[model samples]
Target: NGQSTNSNEKKLAFQNIPRLPREVTPFASFTNVIELDQRGPLFQGPGAKRDTGRYKVRPTDDDSMKRAKKFSMEQSVKYVLVRQQQHQQRAQLDLIKKQQALLLMCR
Candidate 1:
């Protein structure tokens, strides 16, 4: 009895299934319109490729470039100062070593 009842319930459920293609017609038309809009025009004259909008132009302001150049200059100056300090320390060490050697010889 239970098996027969389950089969009848499944048969009733199958009767209510909706047709998909008919319901999706509006969506298909919308997608078709979008595809038509995306396709660019054919028959281009000579040198027309340069005028196309494929490559979007960026802003003309050079603020970022100027900032990058300033940062590079600041880094270079820091490196130069650090190297100069290292050289000065090395020179001082050499002078101290020479004085120590002279004192040892006097002894």
Candidate 2:
């Protein structure tokens, strides 16, 4: 849990950003979540870093499960995109004859 103060100085998320001394960044493990940043930049304004990525190291099993979840999500999105494209193409083709008839009548 972390907390911070907003412009109004109101109490906020108790989470804090994790940072390692420059001297220790090299030693930091990529898998070890070195930082915990929650909802900070969103309130930080333009100067605040948006979509800041934090690093974390999870167990190898957890990593695989995460990958599987991500892969399934991405695959579903791709499948939908392809399906939509096919539907759109079919619609265009189906409408072509009607468009040609309208053009002939207009001429």
Candidate 3:
């Protein structure tokens, strides 16, 4: 009787196992994240036959070329402004030092 009851229990357990939900659909793909698309030409080299090289042109290069003369003048103006500021700051500090020395000598 005990052996028969154990067999029935085993059968009951086996029946419960398949009732649980199974994977209806397959897992999502990982190819998109794993394989990123390149931004440039596939192949490029001096010895190679093809000239497909991934070379991204910098925005700064394009900007400089588009406004080469304007940028030069603007850069000159900026340099002069910075130089003037530095000279003014140095002159003020020198003036302050001279005033302090003069006061000390007078005292």
Candidate 4:
């Protein structure tokens, strides 16, 4: 029994021994994390270099301006036609409701 106790004490002393600095470095348990930004413009195309200045006004070509004006006018005409169609549909609905009321009164 005394020999067994002495062996147990030796085992505990070995376990409590101070480890070397290299052995205790914890390099295997450490982690390093790096994050990269993914926010800005996806494709910095050729035009980006020329667009550095905020207040620089680029002149619009006459041809493009004319085309834009034509497109705007066409959109306006389309909206006017759609509005007329909506008004006609509402007038037809009101006429149908009035006719329904008159028939109900006669009955």
* Local distance difference test scores for all models: 0.83, 0.77, 0.85, 0.88
User: What's the ranking of the predictions by lDDT, best on top?
Assistant: 4, 3, 1, 2
Give per-residue CA lDDT, model 4, range 1-107, as digits (tens): 99999999999999999886864786656666898889977987876767556674346766777889999999999999999999999999999999999999999
In the range 50-69, model 2's lDDT, one tens digit per residue, is: 77687675799788989999
Which residue pairs come into collision in candidate 3?
none
Residues 1-107 of candidate 1 have per-residue lDDT tens digits of 99999999999999989767855766655434344454766776886756546664356546766788899999999999999999999999999999999999999
Worst 10 residues of 2 by lDDT: 5-14
lDDT of 3: 0.85
**Deviating ranges (above 4 Å) for candidate 3:** 1-66
Model 1 CA deviation exceeding 4 Å by range: 1-61
Question: Ten-residue segment with the worst summed lDDT in candidate 3?
Answer: 20-29
lDDT of candidate 3 over 1-107, digit per residue (tens): 99999999999998888543344435634445577879987776678777589778699987877798788889999999999999999999999999999999999
TM-score of each predicted structure versus truth: 0.44, 0.39, 0.38, 0.44
